[model samples]
Target: MDVRVTDDADVAGAADETRSLLAWLTQEDELRGRVTPQERPPVPGTLGPVLDGLVVALGSGGAVTGLTTAVVAWIRSRHSDVTVKATRSDGASLEISTKLVGPMTPQELRAFVTDSSRLLEGGQGGQGGPGPDGGAL
Candidate 1:
């Protein structure tokens, strides 16, 4: 999975922020060996060098759940608006926003997870629950 992180103009350190997120995920017991920094070609953006993205190795059963949980929590812990996009090799992907996940209810969160799991696991299309405001990819 290619995990991309983006932040608002006020927090233009998206690449740096992604690195921090990598650290956070690395510390999670469930995500320890699953998270690793990956490279993306530099683009014209103030976000800097395009030196971001985490290539998470997601296996079956609960792997997506733990990854998303850790990711959402990391986003919420931040003050700036940060968004995440998780995409599988099959091109199925989803994007979630910190603004959306911060106030999400359990049901909404479940929907996000269900939607994430489906995409991350190689499925595509309609989501079973309310998805993240960041929209689908």
Candidate 2:
């Protein structure tokens, strides 16, 4: 998932919104819950190097403010089997990038959440590419 925090001026608010969003996601049957950060090699390491993903923006109240172009780039690099893009809301003037990573199951979403959690706990966020076996996914 590519999440962006457009309003950096209010980092605390953004975090709050992130927490609320995560909570809401957990309650939803469709979305995979919160991202569980995993422990992997750091971004500087060679084995399973961490990839620089999109930056999610949090509003003053911790709500998702907006997304950026980086989100689109990250989605494209991570999920090659799918197509991703973003659009702006004319009324709200909010820019959001949506990436289609095929389809995400509840279980997969949970796994992603776990992986995200691990990343937050200092683990490598996303894999740069394929491994020795040429496994990208």
C-alpha RMSD values across all candidates = 4.7, 16.9
The models' CA-based lDDT, in order, is 0.68, 0.30
lDDT of 1 by residue, 1-137 (tens): 54433333234676688778889888888778887787666666645456557888877777777887787788878888877776666554566677678888877776777666666666663322235543463
Top-lDDT structure, candidate number: 1
lDDT, candidate 2, at 79:
21
In model 1, how large is the Cα lDDT of residue 137?
A: 31
Alpha-carbon runs more than 4 Å astray in model 1: 1-11, 40-50, 125-137
Clashing pairs in 1: none
TM-score of each: 0.72, 0.25
Give the true-structure RMSD of model 2: 16.9
